[model samples]
Structure formats: structure tokens, C-alpha cells
Target: MDTQIGCAIKASNELVKNLHRDGFDRGCIATFNDYMTTFTKNKASLHRSLNGINNAKNGTRLYDSIVDVIQIFRNRGEVSRPWILVVVTDGDDNISSRSLHKCAQETSSLFTTKESNNFLFLVGVGDGVNSEKMNEMASAGNFIYIHAKDFFLLELIFLKIANKITTSLSLSLGNLTVGDHSASWAEVQRHRNLSKVAIDYALLIDVSASMNSRVISSNSVTNLNSVITHATRAIGQSFDSRIINTTNVALLASWIDKKRGNPYNFSDLPFEFKLIHRASRDGFGNDKFHNNCDNKGPTIVVIKVKYSGEIIGGYNPLEWRCVKINEWSTLLPNNHDFYIDQQRRTSKSFIFSLTNQTISRVTLNNDAIIWSRNKGPCFGLQDLCITNNFGKSEQRSYENRIINKKNFEIEEYEVFQVIDKRPRFSIFYFIFMIFMGIFKIIKFIFMRLFLGIYWTCYIVYWIIYWITYWTVITLICVAGIGLIVSILALPIILYLYLEAEIAWVILSALFIYAPILGLIGEYLVI
Candidate 1:
């Protein structure tokens, strides 16, 4: 038992260091089975004492162990940092007074009081382990339930859990709305991929004559038009000078004529071709973008920006522009429409400075743009791929098809591939099992049966309604058909039995009349 604890701790320590995660601080180590020892910071002494420790005498009290850990967190008064509680058990609880539900509630409460980043890991090894109880004891987010038939797999499971924790802590998206903003944090955490991929991007910039003029309301060192134009030009220059010439980049431009709100054609735009190339075709060919990026292996990306005049007031408002990308779209209009700048009272202008990319810009929408020093593809591109698989150019669309044996082929795939990976049993399966078990016990105690009586009554009702109606209707239809057949055969029967020529004449008339009557019945039903 002590060896397992030492092995898990050692593996976790090594993983944290190897993954470049913050080092872990040694916390209290305690064991409980309807009883608990005081938590000690001296992990070395605790491990040394583990060998002498004997098997717990009583039944496994999983709840008590969880409560002890929660108590330790409360005593330490450290609510800001992340804490993890790992419970390893081999059998079900039998003698503990504390119910499993109580333990889960306490676990949830403990984490709720903190920053909500705490974790719980329940490892159940060997047969007779109660998987349901273990799952119940684990709090939702970052918590995991691992089941292994042997102790040998425990070490591997611990290592996997440690790796997950390390990866989660490494990618700190400062203010990016990924996990915390979602309704289900556990689901969001499951699909998070921190890996970076190259991107093939398109940039469309607005460079109208308005960009060269000063703001209508203010005096500034630089015109609102020049700020965006220079900033965009600089961005284009960086892409051309810093990036490889073979990089897949489609540049387009939109412009305004002398009239306000009147957009100009790409050819009429008065801009240097060196800064940006005009789009050759309307509705940019998504197919060609992927083809150009195939050799380079860059994720597909597109961005369109429109400068809609200047924002009236704010700390960093002058250079604001409405930007839309394939991954996300924002209408950052250059005006105070969402909220009035109460601080300025009257609308005032802030000088636009495009030097620092990290300097927070003021826009109607409070979205922050992450600028990379490497001038890599937009970071939001990663979010799009992780959440929606939006940038996988190799993925074939509905229009894409293959001909096999000179025949057209249709291919189908799972929509939510990530969610589909998780297997689920029908809820009715559990309900049936639980209900049957409880009903048997109730019948045994009360000397009265409920299910059997209910089933008998239901069967009797079904026979009275459905069976009687179907049987009577079937008999009536069979009789009617038999009567018609017998009536037609009567003439033939008389001719054989009576030995009369008149019987043959009656036989012909009977056959003709039977057909006419049948046709009349059919027409009436229709």
C-alpha cells in the first residue's frame, strides 16, 4: 500500500518537472478507513513509516478519507491555488456511517469555495470495486474515474493523469474565452489541444482616401485614416519581408470613394500593388487556398478588416477598425454606440499609437487581440481548429467525391467525432436494474408482490381489449368468405347429386352473379 503512494508521488513529481510545469509543493499525507491520521507536510517521514503500516482493519470508508482532505484544505486557508485529491481503493464501503452522496457534496462544496480549479482522481483496482460510488465521489471538472483490474495498471493510470494536469496548466490563455466562458468546463477541457499549426491566410484591408485625412472632431499627430493604413501596410510588409515568398497569402483591398459609405472596386483602389495583391476572383476559391497550402502544410485562415471612421472617445480608440476573420468576427465600429464615455462627458479623441501590439485597444466589443512576436498565424485559429476542426484543409467536403470502379461513391462521417468517442449506456438499463432489485426486497419484507400483480392485471386488460376485438373481427371475415364460396359451389354440388341438366345452367349463372356481388362490395368500400 505504501509503495503505491510513493510510486504515484514520484511519477507526478518527475512529470511536472519534465513538462515545464510549476513544481509541486509537498502537502499532507494521510490514510483513512473509517478513521484518519493527521496530515503531515513531512512526506519523507510519512513514506518511511508506510512500510510498518498494516492493512486497515475495518471496511473502506471512502467518504471519511475525502472529508479529511477537505478539512486539510480548509485548515491551510489556501483557496487560490489548485489542489488535487487522489483516492485509491479496492473494495466497496460496508460499515461507514457517512453516505457516498454526502462525500460528493462536501467535495463539490470544498472546490466551489476556492478558484474552482481543484481536481480529484479516483482509482479503483481489482474486482468488487464499486465504480458507481467512485464516480459519484469525484467532483465534475478535471476529475477522472480510472478502473483497472490489477495493481500493475495503477502506475500507468497515474502517469496519464499527471500528463493531463501538466498540459492543462501549461497553456494559460490569459483572457481567452475557452474553458471558463463555456457552460460545461469539463467538456471544454477534454478537447483542448495546445499544439500549434502553420496557417495559410488571406488579409483584406481598406485603404480609401479617408484614411489619409484627419478626424472630423479632433486634433491629433496622425490621422485616423493614416493610422489604419500605416498599420495595415506595416502588417503586409512584415508578411512579405519576414515570411517566405512561397507562403500562401491572398491579399485583397476594399476602398471608399469620395462619397461616404460608398465602397470601391478592387481595381479602382489607389494603393500600391506591392503592399497587397488584388483578389483575382470573387468569392475567394476555398479549393485553391488549400491546394496552394498543401505543399506547405499550413492551416487555412482568412481575415477581412474595414475601417468605419473613428471612435469618438476612449483610452485607445482612434485606430479601431471592424475586423472579421474566418475563425471569429467583430464589428468594432469607430464610434461610441454601445456605451457613452461618461468619463470624457463629451466625446474626446485619443491619439492612436500602433507601436505596442500588447497595449489593450478600446472597442465596442471587449475582445482582446493576441499578437505574437514571431508574427505567427492568429492564435484564435487554434481555438477554431480545436473547437470546430475548421482549418483542416485535407478534410474532404460534401462536394468532394471519389469514383471507384467507374461508379460514383458517397462517403459519410460522424458529425461530433469528439463527443462520439465517449460511450454511454442507456438510462433505462440502470433504471430497470435498480427498480427490480428494490422491488424484490420490498416483496420479501412485506409478504406482498407488486410487479407480478401489476403484470397480471395488464395482461388481462390487453386480452379483453385487443385480443377480443381482433379475434371476433377475424372470425366474421372468415365466415363471410366461406359463405360466398359455398354459395358458388352449390350449383356444381346439385348437378353431381341430383343428376339434372338444369343444375349446369344454374352453375353458370351463380358464377357470374358471385363476381358481380364481389365487385359491388369492393366499390362500396372504396
Candidate 2:
């Protein structure tokens, strides 16, 4: 009854707004706290009056108020419109003069009998709610009982309810068929008419370690906390806008543990990544991570992608690596301000191309495909003008790429070898080496013997020339002194050699010839 009053007023306000949005503003909202107090068609007056219904009320007059509102709508001919009644209370009725049995009978008779024109929904609040009693007050199949413990979730609850009421959305399996049988029995490819454009999606969240952390909010541009918060908020905003028209948006039933926090946990690590083993069993008797959620859709299990830093156990650069059942697939990090899931092999891993500048939005919807949510100007010293437009655009993905079957396996080794190939060396890098090799061949092998012989011949010729010059000088000086003596004795010697006997002349000629020959030979040759 404390915060329940505020939640009730909020819901009522949303319902009226939704009605006006759907072009059916001809309606009235009545708030029943301790008693059925006000009913008005004016939206502003209705909101003001509803806010006046405070937390002071002890008993919720749920039955009496519903009957009164139904009669009012009936009298005003609002029954002709798509009439619906939503009752939000703590499921406690102490002050109502009308008994629970009488209220149930009247609700069934008046609303259920006229099913086409009337509908009743009862929402219970707090832990001590009597669901069976509330169910009895509701019409057979047109009733829904919603329980909420936290008031923050009232906005989401009201929004969900408002979205449903305004759209009047419904799903049917009878009209859906695969081949010759109904879709319920067969694996149908096309569930709806292909001509009509409609997209339905089921959001599967992993109850892993990080999903439960409360995101610490900040205005700092370079803070990691701020980037994560912005990303998560953007993600939530995308979901609200993109999937509203779609039929199915499945949330994990275990996420309905209202005592813990909102279904969408925006907290940080240690507190965030805790797992849920049993839904209904825990230390506290209350259901914090329990399976009592009213959302009736298929529960999907997701394996979270490992971040590059988390994988290497240190401060690593941005890289996205998908988790594998058998082993961890290591991927190289991209050293840029923006991050893209580069190791995509299957069609499901292909998110929107960041290179496409025309695309104003992108989504990390691929399962097992790792992505860096910790990116943006908000996570840096200043904003970067990256091509992807990081924080300035919407990021979203709506395709159910997994359901459509296609397979292509690309080995990481092949991809790394191709993408990480080293650049080729310059052509002129070995120019000096080439020239040196050519010069060495010319000097050592081809010209070696010719150069040696030429040097030896040149040295011997120089030595002979110097020796001849010195010898000529010595001969001139010595011959000058001997010339005088030779001239005086030449006549006598010559006369003796000619006139004397043959033996005496031969001995004298031989001695002179021997000395001349010996001197010339020793000086020139030795």
C-alpha cells in the first residue's frame, strides 16, 4: 500500500496516455485506494486526481472500484470502444463492503459475459498477495495477474501494459502452417504472410557473471563506467523502439526475481556476473533469481563472448572473441578507437558493417560473437571522429540470423595469416650488397694472375734503369784517370804485341780480354 499507490497512479496515467495515442481518448480513469474516489475523462485532471491517491491508504477497495468503473463506462457507452480495466493493488481487501465471492460473481457475469466489449486485468503487489483470490475476481481467459515488489519496475510494467493495450496485439498458430499441416505440428518456415513486413524476436540473455552489475553513472568522457552505462541505456532504448511492434520479445523467466533488482540488471562485475542454478530455491525464502516470471515465451541459454583482456588476464587492447564449447578461440585485437567483430565465419556473426557510413545505427545481436561495448567518446579523453560515428548513432540488430540455416567454417590460422601478413621489403634494400659482390669477383678471380705478373715486371724494370745510371757515372770518373796512362803506354804495348813471338802476344791479349769481360758481366748481371 506504500509505493503501490504511486505505481497504481503511474499505470493509470500511462493507460490514459496510451488510449489518447491510439486515437481513443474518450475514456475515464478511476483510482480506488481506501475507497473509489474520482473518475474523469480529462487526462490532466485524471493524472492530478490520481497523484492525490497517496500511500496513507491501508485497505485496497479493488472489487467495489472495478464494479463502479465498469458501470460508469457502460453508462457512458465506452463499452462500444475497446473497453479494458486494469486493477493494480497489493491483493489485500479489508475495507470493501462487497464480499470477495459476490465481487467475483459480478465480475464474471458483467465482464466475461460481454467478452467482446470488456476485459479485466488484476495486478498484485508485495510478497503477501493472494493470487487465487485475485484470479477469481478476473474474467476466465482475459485476465492477467502481475506482481511487482519494486516501484522502479512499475514504469517498465506500465510501459509494457500500455504497449500491449494501445496496439491490441495478438498471436495465433491456427493461421500459421508449414506445408499441409498447422505450424504447431510442423517446423514452419514462413509463419506470417510474406507480403506484410513484420519482425518478431526473442531476446535471450545469459545469466552469467556480468549481466547483473549496476552500472555506475557518470558524466566523464574517459571513464569506462560511463561508456558501459551509455551503451546499456542505448541498448534498452533500441529494444523499446525496435521490438515494440514485433510479436515476441522473450525475457528469461528467472530474471523476474523482483527482490534482487530490475530484470535488466545494469550493475558492474562481482555483483553482476553471479549465476542462477535453481530458480525457486535460494538462501532467502523470497524469490530473487527465481522462475516465477509471468512472461510466457521460450527460455534461451546464451554463452557470453570473452573480451580480449579477460582472455589474456591483463590490460589488453580491444578484440572480440566468441566463446566455444570445446576451447577458447583467440583473436587478434584491433588497435583503433572503434571495435568491430572481425572474426565472423557464419551469417549470424555478421553485424552491420561499420564501413557503411550511411548506416546511422549498429547492433551487437550476434550470439557467441564477441563485441566491445566499452567504446565511445564517453570512454575517452575527447571525442573521436571515427567513421562509425561511435556515440552519435543508434546501434541495433533485429535479424534472427541463427534460425536460418547456413554454415561456412573459416580457420583463424588462415585468417590471421592473411590479415596479419608482413609487408614486403624495399627493392633497393640489397643494392650495396649486389655491387660489392660484382667488384669482389672482378678483383679476386678474373684479374688476380694478370695483376701479379704486371706488378713483378714493372718492379724489375725500375731496378735495372737505376743500376745503369749509377754504373755510367762510375765508368766515366774512373776512365778519366786511366786515359792519360793508357795513351802513353799504348804505342809500346801495341808494338810489342805485333812484333814479338805468337806465344808472348797471345798471353798479353788474353789477360786484357779476361778483365774486361769479367767487369762488364759482374756489374751488369749480378
lDDT of 2 by residue, 1-526 (tens): 2244544565566545433322223445454542333334455765565566553434456566666665665455434345556666654665678876555544444443332434345656444567556543432222444555444344444444443332232243345321221112111212222212221110011111221223232334444333233322322221111101000111121121112432222221111111231211222111221222112121111111111100000000122232222233235433423333322222222211111101111133232222222321110111110111111112223232221112111110000000112244455657877888889988786577888899999999999988988887776555544455445656766887779887876676665455555555565664
In model 2, how large is the Cα lDDT of residue 171? Answer: 40
The clash count for each model shown is: 1, 13
lDDT per residue for candidate 1 within 1-526, as digits (tens), equals 2333333334333322232211224344445532233434443544443433334344565566666667776676355556666666666766456676556545544553343345456666556577655543442211345565544344445445444443345464333231221212233233223422111100011111211222122323343333323222212222221111111111111111122343332223433223121112211233332223222311222221112111010121112122223223255454433321111111111111111101112221222122222221212211111111112111111111111111111110011000111235578878998999999898786665666787899999998899768866765676577578777876776665577567666776576466656655654564
Instruction: Write down the TM-score of every candidate.
Output: 0.31, 0.31
| Whole-model lDDT per candidate | 0.36, 0.35
lDDT of 2 at 128: 51
Residue pairs with clashing backbones, model 1: 211-225
